[model samples]
Target: MSEKILFVFEGEKTEHVIARNFISHYIQKENKTVIKISFCGEIYQLYKKMSEDDFGIEFVDLFPLLQERDENLKKYKRDDFSQIYLFFDYDPHATNASNSILNELLDVFCQETEKGKLFVSYPMVESIRCYNGIEDNFMDLLINIDEVAYFKQTVNSYAHKKYNNVPQWTINIWSEVIDLHCRKANLIVHSKNDFPEREVPQDLILTKQIEHENKSNNVIVISAFPLMLLSHYGEKTASILQNLA
Candidate 1:
């Protein structure tokens, strides 16, 4: 059997679109690996689903009884996947319930860092679009506008609208968009490794390490997903991000 890689995302919109497109392109070229993508609404929902499916306990029930439950669940080890990634964003405006949910999810992911990896985009998933080395400029353009509003107006809406217009928006078109915007800013888009990192929890294992100049700069940290693809597939991943305009 081929090596199975699973990606679970936080939503069905942009995250799903990017993950699905990247996985589809990746598997077509890489016959040795099988990729599967799933969306479970949010980070907490993903934790809840994984816990119940893999350990037979809800997130709430797992914490207090973790010692006993972990011992029992060891016998039911889930070793089918070669790699499992959870894609989420660190939204500053998240609800109280969502914040609490992410705290629990972070706790569980920290414990299973070897088996489960979390790829969190700071601010929002739109950060991935901003990863083309022009983030500072792009963010500056959004200074007067909210990030979500800018994303919806620029990246998200543009993709969907273009998709509708053509009946099929190929990966080449996606590449064109990236190249056009990145080149316009005189930016040389690099891979995930080149991006700067913001501080996360000390206990959390970030797959890729990056540094920030200061506390106030808007930084995009992609710990897995696209970075994993880039590491394994190289230029193919970059091709998907953008090509020369």
Candidate 2:
């Protein structure tokens, strides 16, 4: 039977494009199918409307939510997918940029096999490939909250010319991106200046970034796309990332 993975994306174009490159390069399963669904609104808005009895985000079923916003998801069932992954941005400028809300959402959606795993791209979805042409050592890269709303424009102006079309990225280019983000995730979470040795939970990364934001008011530059690839594909992808170093 073919393994089916459902990708729920907030930034439809960017997330799907980046995911396509990674999926095409790293996913070797001959019988694997990827079903993509895009959410048109901010995740915080979803949290606000869906809070439960205790004003806590207890139940979040992405299938129904996706169906509510997109008419195409009416036929898909939750059980049909082997795994479910969600990709969203950390838009701190939003009116509902509360740490508690994001933390609760992260806690509830922690399991990929069950409820689904949520991966957040710090600041915005463009962080996955917002590598500036001049800054090679971007592990310490941090962007202020005030400037976050304009991040997509910054990426358009500063990111390497080649990254303008992420969907066209070759395997070698994808390998480089995966390698860069894997190491950056380690630095952001564990404060280690090396590649991640083991899988670090997305919630942990979120917690740390939240703490950092409280203190410094700047969010680290890390993307959920590469980490998602590393988590799902494991060492098959890691081996390629490691060799690139």
CA lDDT scores, all candidates in order: 0.43, 0.77
How many backbone overlaps does candidate 2 show? 0
Name the runs in model 1 displaced over 4 angstroms: 32-39, 44-77, 97-113, 126-136, 139-225, 231-245
For each candidate, C-alpha RMSD in Å?
A: 8.7, 2.4
Candidate whose TM-score is highest = 2
lDDT of 1 by residue, 158-220 (tens): 333443322144666545433333332222123322322222231232211122212333333
Model 2 scores a C-alpha lDDT of 0.77
User: What's the CA error at residue 194 for candidate 2, in Å?
Assistant: 2.1
**Which residue pairs come into collision in candidate 2?**
none
Please write out the lDDT profile of model 2 over residues 1-245, one tens digit for every residue. 77888888885576777777576655534577888888876779767666743544565456786788767678888888888888888889998787778888888888899888888888888887788644455676788988998888887886888766688777777777777888778777787766676766787888888878889999878888888877876656577665543
Off by over 4 Å in 2: 28-30, 52-56, 133-136, 240-245
List the candidates' TM-scores in order.
Answer: 0.50, 0.90
